[model samples]
Target: MWVLVFFDLPTETAKERKIYALFRKNILKDGFNMFQFSIYMRHCASRENAEVHIKRVKKILPEKGHVGIMCITDKQFGMMEIFHGHKTVSANAPIQQLEMF
Candidate 1:
């Protein structure tokens, strides 16, 4: 099981600080690896372990902010695909990716 965890605050001001603090306190406890900014993807030995982590995250998260967790199976960890204005671009083609002009 792959879990994608995201954290969002109500405002930009102080959001990074608060989120980072929460991340340090909660997510780091179980030694899970982060997948992206404000997102953590981890493989657990069992569902109980995942649930415990999620509960801990919920406990530490800010009351006013939004936190989301999604579980997906068999998804590549670093699969890259470019999208232009909601359109998917082939990875093999010479189309300019979003990172370049």
Candidate 2:
């Protein structure tokens, strides 16, 4: 499972800008990786774990621009197509197994 967060918060005033920074920091602190500007992704061990992170995001949500939270199966997340210009990068592949030392 994956918890994907997409947000656009107001930054018109100093206070609003502070809020925006705090929100971004909160998400990062909560273990989300930067997927793109204003977008983040966190891989969870299970659906229940994803729900926990989702609730944390909601707690720090701003009362301004739109903030979206979504959960997708690992298969769906693996289908993402990332490209830069004509070059393309494959989505993250799941580990087949972990070798013991």
Candidate 3:
């Protein structure tokens, strides 16, 4: 599964910009990669694992602006079609994690 985070935070004032930067830093520290300017994503082993990351993101949400979290299966994610202008581009392969028992 993939955990995707979308956010649009206020950046009008210096304080608001600081908050936005911190929010982005926090999610990156949580293992999310920048899928786009305001979109971040992380690959998870399972729904439970995705939920844990989602909770962590929730805890650090800024007081202002909007944030959204979504989960998609590997199959669903793979079906996504990406393009760079007129050319089609392949999506980045998911990172493999070793599960220690």
List, residue by residue over 34-100, the lDDT tens digit for candidate 3: 9999999999998999999999999999999999999999999999999889999998787898988
Clashing pairs in 1: none
> All candidates: CA RMSD in angstroms?
10.7, 3.0, 0.8
Clashes of 1: 0
Give the alpha carbon lDDT tens digit for every residue of 2-83 in model 2: 8999998889999999999999999999999899999999988789888999999999888888999989988998888899
Q: State each model's CA lDDT, in order.
A: 0.61, 0.89, 0.95
TM-score of 1: 0.57
Best by lDDT: 3
Residue 50, model 2, lDDT: 87
Model 2 gets an lDDT of 0.89
Better of 1 and 3 by TM-score: 3
TM-score of candidate 2 relative to the true fold: 0.89
Residue pairs with backbone atoms closer than 3 Å in model 2 (clashes): none
Order of the predicted models by TM-score, top scorer first? 3, 2, 1
Cα lDDT for residue 47, candidate 3: 90
What lDDT tens digits, residue by residue, belong to model 1 across residues 1-101? 45667876555568766666766556766655665566766665456766877777667766666779776543343354657789996533222224445
The alpha-carbon lDDT assigned to residue 98 of candidate 3 equals 92
lDDT, candidate 3, at 79: 94
